[model samples]
Target chain A: MLLKAEKITKQFLRESRNTNQFCAVQETDFTLEAGSFAILTGRSGSGKSTFLHMLSGLMTPTSGRVLIQEKEIYSLSDKDLSAFRNQHIGVIPQGQSALYSLNVLENICLPYTLYHKNAHQEEALALMEQLEIAHLQAAYPSELSGGELRRMAIARAFLRKPELILADEPTSDLDDENTKIVFAFLQKAAREGAAVLAVTHETDVSQFADKVFCMKAGVLTEQNSL
Target chain B: MKLANSLPVRNLKGKPVRTAVLLLLTTLLTLTVFGGTLMIISLKTGLHSLESRLGADIMVVPYEATTKSNLETIVLQGATGYFYMDNEKYQKIASCEGIGQISAQFFLASASSGCCSLSVQIIGFDPDTDFTITPWIKKSYAQNLQKFDIVVGNDLNAFVGDTLTFYGVDCHVAAKLDKTGTSFDTAVFTNSETIKALIQSSVDKNMNEFKNINPDAVVSCVLINVAEGYTVEEVLNDINIHVKKVKAIQTKDMISGVSDSLSGIADIISLLIAVVWIAGIIILLLAFTMSVNERKKEFAVLRMLGASQRKLAAMVMQEALLVCLLGSLLGIGLGLLILLPFNQLIEELLNLPFLLPSAGQMLTDTIAAVLVSVLSGGIAVSASAFRISRMDTALILRGEN
Candidate 1:
């Protein structure tokens, strides 16, 4: 298994009530094999995003554990966990995730530069060309359209070519054509031996998934592939 | 570590207005701290130099001179005025009990000294009996002054071997003295013979106040040094009681007025510095806070990109450090620009002595001021860096917090 979650759960304390707690995600066990594409679908407030945040090691699970390549990720220190994620996993966040100050090309190189390493400019430009944002390399995020910005975010996540890819609403702002383009890219990443998990509301996303899951009211359930 | 060429600099460049405001605030803070401190130190140094240049225990001036002119204005300031008592008083003061050394000084003003726009005070001291001027003059001139040989003060336009015509009598400048930031800096010093000849020339020229004055058998003031066992007050009292027309004033008494004025000015400057620091810190704190609050989502995105909490905090601090470094150097440069060129004007405006310290001491002070400026900037932004580093990344990324 490239990624595994064993009975993971998340809870939030209601700010107005000191003694009360609300569970955002509940008792979820999941696993993904190498070179597999998984699609998670749920409505708003269904905790789909919350579950992905836990699996990606951005939030510590209230119970249970997440293991990536059989190493318990949350068991490591915060600094080590951050490094682990940078080297092994890529997360594409929801809306407006690009740093406004950096141009599109520089934004794509942020993962390398964050560790003070030299960026691979040739690889970054090749990825931008593949995503059709090569012409907008010098443009800042504010000058980009919703669809173009989403494509840039996708290209940035693939820059490091991580073993695991977690994306939230990857095609939320795209039209039908751009949506199909981004889904094909995610499927390609999985075929190249990466475990890719994408969360979306679009039912058509199931056509590209090797496995599918549904989240509703903080509870997760698996569904047969389309 | 390579922060100068990092995202911090690019971020600052992206938002030009915020960066400019921060730089301007830091600049003002350093300017006030460095410039204000330099002025206060210069005033204190000037006072010390004035006291050292006087180098006398007591001055016995004509009683009429004290009543007619401010003693500080005449001694510490190079205001042109003359008063004389009969030479009998000098002889009497010499024989007084516990007298260390007594020197008679002659005073004359040139109508048009050809050196300055205004008349300059020419002071003539008896070389054999002088205790005040001889030691300092020896540093520049080894030989005793001849009849026409003159040593000009630091502020004078004449140098060594230069001819200074005072009241139509050509005098040779033997040497120039170092600056003392006192009236001595503007006065010319020579032996009694040369001053007498110059006075006689002035009388022959029929200059105002030079007529009807006999240069013979007269001395303007007597500089006295108390013996080791004698107190200055005791000697001053003796001179005042036994003497008829002379008033003996202690050197400390002559400096008290200027010292009191300087104290008031120092207090005002200190208060202004405190206020500037408080205001600068508050402004910077608010600036950092507002800037961080507006970019909460950006910080969250960075966190999502696998930047640790410490890295985020370091980025904020790096931006502040770069801004402070540039702003403080510019401020020190501005302070030097303002203080060095207008030092004479500042001295005149304040009516107090102003002397800057040596170059090495000043450079050390500049470094200290720059460090303080940068440190204060760090302090001002510390709260923001901490808060943003600890913010909830998931909540911010979800756009809920």
Candidate 2:
């Protein structure tokens, strides 16, 4: 196993309108083998995105040890941990995830460029080529269509060859062609030895991952094995 | 660092419309500030040098000129139009107790032609014993000076020949005075007899011009020299009480009064302009704060990416510094462009034979302008940076764009 997120719990502090604190995630134990792909499925406000945030080192779980090769990312200093997350984990947000400041090539290369990693322009082009939009390399994120943007976002995640990829709603609202392209890339990344976690409600993307986890309220439970 | 480095100056690449608006306002603010500073400095330096070269303790001109505003127009410019004393009164002044050597200068006017309107000041003095004018007089035609011979101030001699008609009488330019860097730079000088004769004839000529029955007017303003131990005020009071019709003013008093009067209206205008400039700086602060606020999401994302609050603040500060640096630099360059043309225009009109930065005031004004721009920009960032650092990362990550 390359990562273990065991006994994860998260509580969100509610404002004075309710004057109450509520747990968003509670005691969720999870394990992922190297090169495994999983889909986290949940309804709105069901804590699926919260769990993915903890797994990606973007947010800390109230209680848990999320270990990537036995290094607890949440426990590291702010700078050290962000560096670790940028180096080893890739985060892909929902639709319109691409930063407009970067062009198609720069958007795809952002992961490596922002972290000061050695740049490989050819690799970013190759990834975009696989998504069938190699010709759109110079296009801005705003100029691209929904499908082109989603493909570009996936390329950014895969650019650095991160050990773990966490994407939120990887193919939500995307057309069927884009949906297939996104799923195909996620599966390929897993097969190539990266742990991939996609949080989604879409049934089409859910079926593509090797394993699945379901969340209700603030708790996670095993739904299937690969 | 890498983000800013990786992108073209964001103004060039960022939302093009917003960048254009920002650049326009920044450029206007900078130009106004830079040009305003140069004008102020130039005026001050011009006046300061004027005060420094006046070789007198007290200048006893007519009270009408001194009592009026300091910028009162006078033709007391060169040695050619010098003032002669009331003869017995002159002897009385030389005899006064606590009095030092009295250097009496007699005026003789010379026109380019006997008919030309252009006139120059020709003053006559005793070759020895004159303290005020002799220190810088160089030499006074050392070999000999007769009634028709003259020694001219530097630039004045350069124009007229060795023999120019003074009071319609021909006079020789015997030798010359060193450059005085003063209004007197265009005056001619000679012995008392030459000047007295010239005045007698000029009176005769003006009497002929006006067809006056007697001399039109006898000389301009008389200058009094005081001993080293005596202050100008002491001599002024002594002359006021002892001498009749003539008033005495200390050199230092003339300068302060002149500066006050010369810049009085300008000071009022400068104050109003200064307020406008201050408003400009405040606008820059508001612009910078708004600019930073617009990028709040971008900065929050950087913070989420593990950039510390300090680093994020530095990034914002860097943007402001660039704005101020560019704005001020452009303002200064623009100011120089404006000043170059304007200065030439002023120098031509005034001929400023001895111009100094209008009076001791140029430097302070320029410094105030640059400070307003940079200090405001720096303060604006500091005010907003603290609030930014406290922003919650999770909220930003989930917040609506």
Give the alpha carbon lDDT tens digit for every residue of A1-226 in model 1. 9999999999999999968999999898999888999999989989999999998888888999999999999998878988888888889888879888889998998888888888888999999998899999999999999888988888888888899999998888689999998999999999999999999988887989999999998898989964
Model 2: runs farther than 4 Å from truth? A16-18, A115-118, B1-5, B62-71, B75-84, B100-220, B262-278, B300-309, B344-372, B386-390
* Weakest ten-residue segment in model 1 chain A by summed lDDT: A217-226
Q: Can you give the DockQ of every candidate in the order shown?
A: 0.67, 0.36
TM-score of 1: 0.96
The window of 10 residues in a row where model 1 chain B has the poorest summed lDDT is B65-74
TM-score of 2: 0.80
Residue A128 displacement in candidate 2 (angstroms): 1.9
lDDT of 1: 0.88
Candidate 2 chain B superposition, TM-score: 0.69
Q: Which residue pairs in candidate 1 have backbone atoms (N, alpha carbon, C) closer than 3 angstroms, thus clashing?
A: none
Clashes of 2: 16
Cα displacement (Å) at residue B325, model 1: 1.1
What is the docking quality class of candidate 1?
medium
